[model samples]
Target: MTSFLDEFAQAPNLKYLNHAAVSPWPKRAALAASRFAEQNVLLGARDYPEWMGVEQRLRERLMRLLNAPSTDDIALVKNTSEALSFVAFGLDWQAGDQVIISDEEFPSNRVVWEALQPRGVEVIQVNLKGMDPESALLAACGPRTRLLSISSVQYVSGLRLDIERLGEGLRQRDVLFCVDAIQQLGALPFDAIAAQCDFAMADGHKWLLGPEGLGVFYCRAELREQLKLQEYGWHMLEHMGDYSRIEWQPARSARRFECGSPNMLGTMALEASLSLLEEVGMATVGKLIEERVLWLQEGLERLPGIQLHSPMNPARRAGIITFSLEGHDNQVVFDRLKAEQVVCVQRGGGIRLSPHFYTAPKVIEETLAVLHGLAG
Candidate 1:
């Protein structure tokens, strides 16, 4: 087993702090992908059964990561958007039915619900700037609100919401809870069951440390059959491999959402990436991420002309920290950082810095140094 620190062997000069956008694969993930490619080149599909085993392990990992009730609740989807679509289009909606979301949501979380406009479904955007965002969201939920779909953490502001609170609130009101957990799933500990979330989805590319094309969708066991399936194929059938079956039904699990063939290459990479997270344990992974974000936050505050855009309270944030130098244009500052090999991004009208658990202290120190120079 490789030491966790050695798993991320990024280039010496590259100070990467953009885990919110996309993540560099850990060494093990790359090696797994490479081995899968080599196997295809040598053996074709002769070892396909073993590949299915890898896929099963991936599902089990995702199940445990989300603290879901069972692997039966997990579905491998193309991405977060695809999974959100499943929820958006699957549910029975009436005209004037409402779906509540935060004003700070990434477009994926907002647009899918908004697309239901044609169905006469009203989408409410609640302001999360208040001291208690959860309270604001609950206050916005009226008798007409059918569901509350929100990101577990705001993409640009890095505002982490109390999902459990929202879950409890929604439960009393009988409103469905859907979480766009892309920014929170792998960076922090998540519990689908504890949160009582009806549906949740996340991509593997960011904090999950995997490829782009694969993601996980978790549907509560009771809600599985309630969602109308939009896509169909042999693979999603209850008797999937029995091609001779004249009649069939969708699988009695969350696998019903998967339309066709799976992304085996992505499966191998993500399974391997998740192995690292499991090895380190989410409690430690989340602790390390928060510590790094706080480190960056404190360091940014000490720099001259710095104005922070992300939440200052550690409880209100995750791994993201967005700030700006008063004297510097965001693009100009971004370019300077890019030239200096300080990889970050401009978002929410400021520069966004996102670090993973494995990010070294020097990376944060050096990034702050670059910002300090820009501040001057």
Candidate 2:
């Protein structure tokens, strides 16, 4: 069996447990970037076509990542924000059209929909604090609801939604389904086609272990034409290679979402990173991450004078567990963990710890030991 842990030779003091935020790139990904840099320094643009092949591989990898219907359904964008923006502003909004969203969405998901305010579109913030979160969201939908934009996993609470159920429910009502999958895409088995999702976007920086500037957008093949192109460039043209042609139009595929030059450097890193995921298999990746999460959850529950803020249900989680000590403030605990070489973050009401499949056991043990020391 190929051990994922064998590749990571980090510092003896380092305990990286924050994959939900910015992630540390793997050794192979780092080597890839270094090679790319070396190429740039040694001979710039000498093998540009080879780089384009890498970019195409990136699109193919993303198609596999989101289980998009085809490679034609994938677009390499700058980030998730730009993909969400394409769907937000490109849509022809009516005066009474309503966009449904959860109250716990990250600003990227919330702000884009809210930006449609001047176009007479209303963004509805649905409370997802009930026994059945999917049901709560489905119940909030009314006749005028045009689309439901949601995060597959809540950033703070780490509550994973049943996107398939949500998609089926919304599709029955003819509502568009857009999922911000940054927290769930690389962490779990995210299938956009299985969910019947109209749009899915995720940044590569977090769980994908890729660079910050590039991400993936998956638009359902049918919905590609529905969105009117807002941004245009020579690259997005159908006849991109034919510079002499006067008449041109945007690509009929998901490449229509791309408005500018491609990010080849980002493509190199993300493609190499995704190769690891494909080798391990996302189903196994999800199970291994769940195992780590369960270990942390069980350990956290046993600790005295601690409160678990993230959801307890295994059915509703991906790669995050959150907690707060009884008397300590979030920052104090965060700094203490930081000093101990535990890479975690302060989110929601407390500290958030997110570990990936290869997170060493000692990291969790040391984190609990630190918490135990704090409790005393």
Structural similarity to truth (TM-score) of each candidate: 0.99, 0.98
Clashing pairs in 1: none
Candidate 2 residue-wise lDDT at 274: 93
Ten-residue stretch with the least lDDT total in model 1: 1-10
Off by over 4 Å in 1: none
Question: Each model's C-alpha lDDT?
Answer: 0.94, 0.90
Model 2, 202-250: lDDT tens digits are: 9999999888999999999888998988889877888777889988899
lDDT of 2 at 323: 94
lDDT of 1: 0.94
TM-score of 2: 0.98
| Cα error, candidate 2, residue 328 (Å) | 1.5
Which stretches of candidate 2 lie above 4 Å from their native place? Answer: 1-3
